[model samples]
Target: MKKDIILAGVGGQGILSIAAIIGQAALNQNLHIKQAEVHGMSQRGGDVQSNLRICSEPIHSDLISLGRADAIISLEPMEALRYIPYLSPEGWIVVNSVPYINIPNYPEIERLDAEFAKMPHVISFDVDAIAREHGGVRTVNMVLLGAASLILDIEDTKLEEAIGDIFGRKGDKVVEMNVNAFRAGREAGKKQMKG
Candidate 1:
């Protein structure tokens, strides 16, 4: 199976971290993977996106074509909307409902909600709030990963292990915190999927 994903968020939101964890999990499964990152003005809170393609077969390109993505995992709600053109007809959009308002003319929350409401395959929630309540605000990215995990072909344990490996250098406490955050997000995702 092939999973073409677009990971989107503002700078410092750990969008790249999510891509790394997924990429590592794919590698653990011996799957072919390609990744292309656009860090355009990321340090200035500008749009940051990564194209991740994982498949059982060989992949020749690193970029996901327009309207061909299987999923768009976003750490920011507005950032998710920015990539709508990349989503396939049946693609899943796992995004945080919280808006990172760094822009001067950010749209109203109600309007954003209305837009997301129109999508048939959207999993939108205040995942950042969930992460903040569980661990710290820093684990929001992992929370998003946990949400994305529900749609990923990778096993939960593998993703957890990848999280451990990625955050190991920070110490066991940090690793455990992120794992808990991931679990919280996963549970939320499952609940969202059911409802």
Candidate 2:
């Protein structure tokens, strides 16, 4: 089975890091995965999108076409809304409630959100707030992944392992904060599921 995921957010949100973690985890699961990323002046707070494709078989392309995604994990509400068209009707949309201040289009952000809400099985959380509670806004992408893990089968342990692999060597503090951010979002999603 092919599982296509689109991760979208603004730069500096660790969107690519999240993509890397997910891709690494998929590899660990012995799944063949391919990912494509595009940055819009990311070094200066612009948009970033990564298209990740996973399957039991090897992938032929690095990109995912419209209506083929199994899930879309977005770190910003507006970002989530932007990818709705790329999702299959049965796909899940996991959104981080933190708003991505859409460049030059901030005024229409609210309207875009309502449009995004029309998608089926949408899950939203304030992972940014959770990250802030633990450390700072920089861990937002980890939190979004945590939230998505609750609803998807990548597994919490897989994500934790990915985090350790990705950030443990960076420094102990970063590893601690990012791991906490990921777990916080995961727990919040589980709680939401129960309630």
Candidate that would win on TM-score: 1
Q: Per-residue lDDT of 1-195 in model 1, one digit per residue for the tens?
A: 899999998887778889899998889889999999875556567888899999999999889999999999998888899999999988999999889998899999998888888888888888978887778788888888898899988899999999988889999999999999999999998878722
Q: Model 2 off-target regions past 4 Å?
A: 40-44, 102-104, 108-110, 193-195
The local distance difference test score of model 2 is 0.79
All candidates: CA RMSD (Å): 1.4, 2.4
Clashes of each: 0, 0
Per-residue lDDT, model 1, residue 85, is 95
Model 2: per-residue lDDT, tens digit, 1-195? 678999887777767888889888887889998989875566467767889988898789898889888888888777776777788888888887767664665746567667656665777767767878977778777877888887667778987888888887889888888888888888887765421
The Cα local distance difference test for each model comes to 0.89, 0.79
